[model samples]
Target: MPATTSLQSLHVMVWTALMASLIAVGSFLSIPLGPVPFSMQPLFIMLAGFLLGWPHGMIAVLLFVAAGSIGLPVFAGGKSGLAVLFGPTGGYLIGFVLAAGAIGLLTQARKTARTPSQTPSWALGLLAGLLGLALLYACGLLNLVRVLDIGWNKALTIGFLPFILQDLVKLVMAVATWRIMHGRGLLPR
Candidate 1:
């Protein structure tokens, strides 16, 4: 029985590692902007939330960030290190953890709705994803303004405007993917 338990623990660790690697790969596919790059991180973040649920999703994101901080070439533009955490993009990077947790909370809350009919719809899932992204941007923009010594207006112009459309598209795709996969009962939990 002890040997069986040890094997199960190893399996879980392997699963977590695989998910972390997925996030690392997702980070590579990015579109460079002025201060922030539009990246596939959010897609995987939402996927982590949907598939692994609350704590695990957040842990997966944390592991990804930790990997990058420790000199792994896992960030956009092939950047890494503690210095990256102090850079303009740091807040946004940190915010990914919160966003995943928030998304997870929203989904889990919906799961406990008193009536089955009262449960959140696919639209709500999309909203949750968008909200998560917005939280990241909120933190990111604030960091950009302070670190770069720019005013709010300039930050909005340079840091915010460029990514809105691309983010919207991503939000839609994340929503659709969640809806389809969940409806088909194919999502990993």
Candidate 2:
């Protein structure tokens, strides 16, 4: 039984690391659109939570950020180091951590609410994803306002305006992705 438990721990750890790496890959695959880039970071962030749950998913995001802080070049556009964290988009990075944790907690709750044989409710996942996106935008916009010394008007126009639609699409895609993966039993809740 100890061996089984240890093996399970290792399995989850592997998945956690994989999620972190995927986030890094997502950062690289980004399109620069002003202060914030259009990247798949949020998608993978939500997926990490959907699969890993609360602290583990949060840890994965932290690992990704730590890697970039240490000059691993994991941040968007091959950028790295502490400067990126203190830069215009730094708030979004923080958002990623919070959003991942929030999504994981919500999804975990949803899982606990149902039996193993029941199909998990997608509504909760959708709601969780939107909440995660909102956190990201809120953090990102706040940081953008502070870093650029811009008013809410300019910040909202440049930072939030462009992402409104794209972020929603990403949220939907994250839920859909999680549903398909969960259906396949790829990651047990």
Best by lDDT: 2
- Which residue pairs show backbone clashes in model 2? none
- Which number leads on TM-score? 2
- Compose the digit string of candidate 1's lDDT tens values, residues 1-189: 999888866765665677678878877898887678878887787777665557777788889999999999898878899888889888888878888777877776676663533434777788788778888788888988989999999988877788778777777776677667666755444
Model 2 segments beyond 4 Å from truth?
none
Model 2 TM-score (2 dp): 0.96
Q: How many pairs in model 1 have backbone atoms within 3 A of each other, for residues 3 or more apart or on separate chains, i.e. clashes?
A: 0
- CA deviation > 4 Å runs, candidate 1: 1-15, 114-120
Candidate 2: C-alpha lDDT: 0.89
Model 1 scores worst on lDDT over the 10 consecutive residues at 111-120
Q: Per-residue lDDT for 84 in model 2?
A: 98
Model 2 weakest lDDT span, ten residues long: 112-121
Q: What TM-score would candidate 1 get against the native?
A: 0.85
